[model samples]
Target: MSERVIKPVGRGFLFLDSHPAGCARIVREMSGQVEQRTPERRTALVVGSSSGYGLATTIAGLARYGIDGVGVSFEKAPTARRTATAGWYRTAETAALAAELGRSWTFINADAFADTTKDEVLDLVAEQLGGIDHLIYSVAAPRRVDPRSGETYQSALKAIGGAHTTKSLAFDDGEPVLQEVGIDVATDDEIAQTVKVMGGEDWARWITALQERDLLKPGFNTVALTYIGSELTGPIYRRGSIGAAKADLEQTALTLAKDGVTAWTSVNGAAVTQASSAIPGIGLYVSLLHKVRGLETPVQQSIALWDQLTGEAPLDLDDDGRIRLDRWELTDDVQSAVRAQWESATQDNIAEVADTTWFLSEVRRLYGFDVAGVDYEAETEVDVAWPDH
Candidate 1:
């Protein structure tokens, strides 16, 4: 007899929205990367620790490697009637679990771009944990509102002239259908702004701050996650504005190496993460990675990110100090097979070109709606309070 209206308190904010079981699964998966026999007390700092690859790294540090950690994020909690974002709730839950397991940790809610935020993080790490041995950066944002200038900087993806429409896949439904989307060619200022927010400048700043504070230990190790898809999805992603930012990231990794900082980028195999799903032609790519890895091992198994973080040898890294997991390059043979199919792909050959069953099912699983062993109809709730604005 009543209609409840929901106007969320924070801008684009949510609370208690992560699938607990899935978060656990990912954390457990990452923990397996820690060698069984090694025993050591390690301290870590994970920037962008709330979701996606950043969260995965944090989980690995705690659950798998038995390392205590400090997490820096801007994660907000969910409001009533509005669903919470996955990272917000998962971070809270993960912290709770880690506590029960006797892991020492700290999670900070602060804008990483600000000098004040960076200093605060450094202070926290130094006071509580002594110093950091590992640092992981995994931040991706659409825009950066300059704290000082009060100017809003927005990011764009390069779409060719005119409106571009392509066959988009929706996980809720198993279909590859055409969806009309438009993107603007970036002006010089827009490109600079996007790069500033997403590029290595901020990453370098974070490292500098920690080092200045003497918060970095002698065996300092750091990892930043990056991505590269096959040429088939190049136009919409790899060659787009985001791709440009990633290029900067790759270059930064190389520069960090020159500085004597042990830094490596892990080009992760595609999985449905909050950041990756936002990209244009990524649905099909995620599907393929899942299908191929599923038949063999989970995405976590294929990625040696946790190994790299723990200083384990034999973890593969590209020439420029980044791990290449294009999924296309996994088996070499597997990539060749996909390339052949994609080259001959046409609207008529959509079914043959794309594996509809795998892609569609993975998409649905992204929203926690179609995941096996998950009861989608069951009512779920998570309790987390994002810091006030």
Candidate 2:
């Protein structure tokens, strides 16, 4: 194993390396916060379950609910000289903790959009896990290969109507700055491809495959995590190509429900995630939300979601028939506050106006940096292996 002092290196929200010790520390901490409900054996399946909401939810499912579950994610392993993706290290940490706690948690580092991964996961579920009680689809992929056509599709992060200009946080070359940014509109092909990559077609396939194999448990329920940005980003996000894809995802829930599969879409609150960082205006909005209204960490939000899913209370839904986890972040007063900040905050007063410092820290934490008590100055082991089943 090689060890060296690894400092974070990346422009904007892009992260290059992850720290093993820090990731393991965070995983252990998240596990400590959750109380395992009933030792009764149940199983869960999470697609794209290595980072952001998926990772947080998976940790809660196994640590809190003690469910024997399988987490499906695609993470690049470390090259000879480069470090592995943060998700890779995080998965290893989670599996180790699960084993230590005597819980069955399997981590599959494979292309979830591929048919081969599906076949392998389904076979394991059918033969070993017995049945799946909850399936959480929280995939955030830039591109996907159609299992049938083998054609790769990539999603676009742009407006739909026309070129839209907005003020957002830019933390790359220097201090965090809020500046005007313009995004071009996506073409017809881009819209369709974006939906193909981010929509619920793949999710439907998973459900169909499981049903064909009779792998769904009695009273089984599934949820797909989605987001609807505030009016500040309505054009670039809520009414953009990405929004179109999210709409398709929400509609897929209804189609799945028609098939007798208990499926629903859960609209989650904005948080600092790799995917969110790539979206226009989201970083600035989340940072402003932190300054105005307190922001909820993925771990905290996952706990609340788990409580609702496992609690006796009826699931709260809006008129559109989707769970409203983003309610707190989308309150009338909070949105008004964020709008005022977005319109007025500039490079000189960004720190004074928005919580860019905390937002950047959260982004760095996604890759295991900025974590408390972890000495980034000291040499950390770069060869953290992913735990095998």
Candidate 3:
């Protein structure tokens, strides 16, 4: 018998084991930042509640705030031959931690964009928690199928006005190698489809469904996460097809506000996650940003966002009524420094200008690798159990 080799698959990288140490580190970071002041008897319905910000938000709600609620995600379980997706393991670990804390939590594995999944979540809330006061939407997917028309739309990361070229990084044997990547201009059809897939349509649908069922508690709040990077990456990000979708999402939040749901669009800082990894030049930008601002994980940002939402103080909003968590990353000084590094970064000089090693480690950590105190050589259990609750 021979041992199977683990490696990168498509856009995702894989490792042999779920690093309990890394998970613990994230848990500690999130839990430590949670403010003692929170909404009383808080209950939440977290959409896409498996990985990245979603996972961090769920952990913060259950472990930090001690809120009991339901989590909806579409991650698949592991088999005898292959390990589960990182989200699966993270969810399993979250459930275990919640159980230890004596908190009631439920995980629903399903497509969040589908109406059936929304109905299932409503049923779970109705039967168990009665109603939810908070809804967090952090879904990031490449494609979405319109339940009404059965038309499948795929998202494109291309710039809107024209083709954009930027410096990117590729990992060769765990070393960062600079590469030039060009994003083709998005066609009108591509722009529409990208908007359909990534826009706030699904978020609106979920809120409407819950409201129709009378599942929304009084003063209920719902928030969706978005990103707006500095001007340096504006061509590919803030002004791209994805940016159009984010604009639509912001509009949806405003519309929902008219209905008294207190919906908000939170502009979060950059961090290594499954979604950010696919953006053409984001890795290099994040590495440079880390060099300037010190790397802050999604968990840290999620905790801060939650604090702002539930804290006793009045919620601070910009002219757009958006909570701008990206302020730290978008400050003039930081952007100036990042722009300087971007101008100078190349294959030969990226190591000196940016923190490539830390960036790569963070990317690998997304799939449970490169964590301290995790034994990669030891055999890991592929069949981990989901919590019965």
Candidate 4:
């Protein structure tokens, strides 16, 4: 037996098998956090449910709340010569685990930005799940094509106000190196396009489509994940083009609230994910965040969100009417520590100032590497199938 040698490929990494033990560990952790469950059986519809927070939410809903789920995602499948995306393997493991626990689950591998995908989800909820009690929108993409207008939009991570310079981590020959990254201000068109692609427009569209089909259960709740980081990365994250999109998303939530749907914008903490790793300067900031605040994993964060949404107490909201799941990361002491580290982080001292080793391990784990109890040297099946419910 030879150890599985996974390597970075294009924008994603390749790995043959998902660690079942690792997946189960995450599910158990999420389930253990549930103090109480809803009295009535619930069903959830999750968009972008293959990876990151989306995947964690799906697993937590089923394992903790006993909620059946229908997930919509776009992920590549395995081939004879290559492995499937990590999300594909993760979803397969999730389905198998859900089946083992007698939980209902359905997953659709398709583009959530398209009308066809929305229609398919609506039909699934209408015919199989009856109606959805919770709708989770957690899709993050670089580009989107409008189904109605046939117009394409690409999201940008440029600073909104002006040029900004920050320290960034770049992988050089499989090693992390600190580099100075300067981002130019985004153009007006770029800002508009970023808002179009990453904003809550598609989320609003999905809600409207579900409403038209009457697939939303009475008193159903919908929430879309957003991020508002501290000042350290605010130029490219919280106060950048992505920030504009989030503002638009929050506004969308307001409009949806008026239409009798409980819509919320959940401001989440920054964590290492395929999406966040691509954002300039985020890798370094997250590394510092991990060192300072012991940032929570997506599974932990998802459990927190679920607990808030279904807790015995009413949903906790900030003064702005948004759920502040990021308060832990935004505390004064944490921010001060992160700022001190950010100012001193350099190529020569980054390793001492931040937990780069842990950050790198987390990145590898995203692609099914570094899982405990998984024999990397053992032969494993690459062509895994989703469980039949």
Candidate 5:
């Protein structure tokens, strides 16, 4: 019954609090964009179902397909004088909408990387949904505690082999300032640790667990989200430490295929996500990309992805057996235009050349600020239920 007036607490990719009402507004808007109706009885497991592309696709699955299944994410609850994460609010709103739409869902606020969580999801899938037809592995985290070894691994954003100096961004009193950022090359251990955290080993484990329990449906398909940006972002993304992890992710798909499981590394288009804000040079690259062409949001991309996966069009695959959704963002012309913007960008004229307005607004939107139709000036209820409740 407590309410508070919440405003954005941080700026320029850093956040300290999220507004429940703003987050709910965003969830409602995203849910409204489901144009396709998949009137089929299917079950799905979304590992990271609370935020970003994971959150987007999960909403589409429910709104489009009326799916029955589980969504597992680790989001903290709100406290006195502090708001919960945006995903916390989104999860609650998603559950409400699912119920209103007459769909069944189980939102497990638990660690998806742990073996116990997998076991719980499998049991739920068996008891509630009988089998899982689609498994969306969209998990993203900064660190992971290995369930087997109990060792903690952290993912790094450094480039491999050598340091990469790029036009990066720094925030000054909440405004972005373009600067040259240099990152040292990742050490051998650093690379391995990043892979251990962001790689596909955990995904492979999930598939094996489902197979062991016979919970995988006859046409069970799984996709792990990945990014292989063009040469502009290659040094820090496609060929960087995270890129090594993505490479392992794609390899895991091939390995799963060899084992008679249908899996693909879904190379998705980049839009604004909270995780992307922390990576080096990504802010500048995304800003330039936005200026050259309007960015396709994660929600929009996920809707198109669902269509390709379930609709009449064949699942588009590249030579390496990955779903290609970054074609527009990676077009030669787009990259060339973006590069032009990047090379000429300065703090004096960044907004003129890059979409700093969009970048700033989107980053704020990640934490429930800059959302439409939310009364930021008025007091809002902070305490919201988890999706399962």
Candidate 6:
């Protein structure tokens, strides 16, 4: 081990700008629901379990629901070398905290996209927890490798046909100015590669492997998180390479449902996950939504995601049968409000316009660095190492 080095504390609030008490309340409330709903004997597996939405799902599972869990993540471990990812530290702390409650937890630091990693997870399940009753698929990666050909691939963003221009927010200085981003209208090979990387193949493989290994308990429920953005992100997201991946994911849900699993629907979760943040021109949209409700606190903005997860709101499906998280937020009334505000915004109208600083800050806080209560400067010495690779 390398000698510890002193690092300055991270400044500002971490996570969505919610009061510690309120955020704690939400966790406890959700935990109550989990305890009441899940059977004492049940177990769960959360994919992409190390960070962002995955971390939230794990928190809900362990902290709120009383269900023991196995988390699979492609996370780096803490090191004197500073190689660990943000999720690594958070998950480590979560595991430590969960242990105090006598709740079982396992953190796997292997690539979820790999068949080998899936097999290791199954082996662990058979050896320890027996089987999984609930599976939450929350993995979001920008790149993937084919299990067979060993081909590495990265996804792209492209315009539908011709180049188009749009305005995006600059959270650093809260302004929405017109800009341009383009994609190379994917070639057939490129489309296939995108599907290969972000597609449902890996998910299906995991399910199939667990089923074959007799590791999935009957009545197994699985959820895949996806997004269908508003007209604003259509060119860059909804109609782009990623959209194709999401379509495959949705279809895979129905296929899994047909496999006799009791619930296999994708939740079309809120677009606050790290995956959504990567979508071009999304910061402004988030800021716009925050302004719609006159939201001043981060918890209020974050409550929507939890609402969908636990509140059981009906999923809004588009014409093609995709759940529309973005469109639902962009309802006629909501859009009218956003558009009106957009029209009124000017170079000099920072106050009248949505403040995107909160939006950026919230996403950054999810990494567990910026939140208030946590002391970033203190040497935790607590191992933030990723699970064994």
Q: Per-prediction TM-score, please? A: 0.81, 0.97, 0.93, 0.92, 0.97, 0.79
223-243 in candidate 5: lDDT tens per residue? 998888768778988898899
List candidate 4 segments past 4 Å from native. 1-39, 387-389
Could you tell me the lDDT of residue 90 within candidate 5? 92
Q: Please write out the lDDT profile of model 6 over residues 86-123, one tens digit for every residue.
A: 56666666676568667888888888988888888898
What lDDT, from 0 to 1, does candidate 5 have? 0.86
Query: Model 1, which residues run further than 4 Å from truth?
Result: 1-37, 148-150, 159-166, 171-184, 289-303, 327-332, 343-368, 371-374, 385-389
| Model 6: how far residue 11 lies from native, Å | 17
lDDT per residue for candidate 4 within 96-175, as digits (tens), equals 76787787889998899999988887888888899988999999999999999999999998998789998887665456
Q: lDDT tens string, model 2, 234-263?
A: 898889999999999999999999989888
Stronger candidate by lDDT (2 vs 4)? 2
The candidates, ranked best first by TM-score, are 5, 2, 3, 4, 1, 6
**Cα shift from native, residue 124, model 3 (Å):** 0.3
lDDT, candidate 1, 11-47, per-residue tens: 1111124454454444444455544335488898888
Candidate that beats the other on lDDT, 3 or 5, i.e. the better one: 5
Q: Score residue 113 of candidate 3 by CA lDDT.
A: 88
Indicate whether candidate 1 or candidate 3 has the larger TM-score. Answer: 3
User: Cα deviation of 209 in candidate 4 (Å)?
Assistant: 0.9
lDDT of 3 at 256: 90
Query: What RMSD, rounded to one decimal, does every model reach?
Result: 4.9, 1.3, 2.6, 2.8, 1.3, 5.4
Instruction: Give the TM-score comparing model 1 with the true structure, all chains together.
Output: 0.81
> Which stretch of 10 consecutive residues in model 2 shows the poorest summed lDDT?
305-314
In model 2, the clashing pairs are 36-64
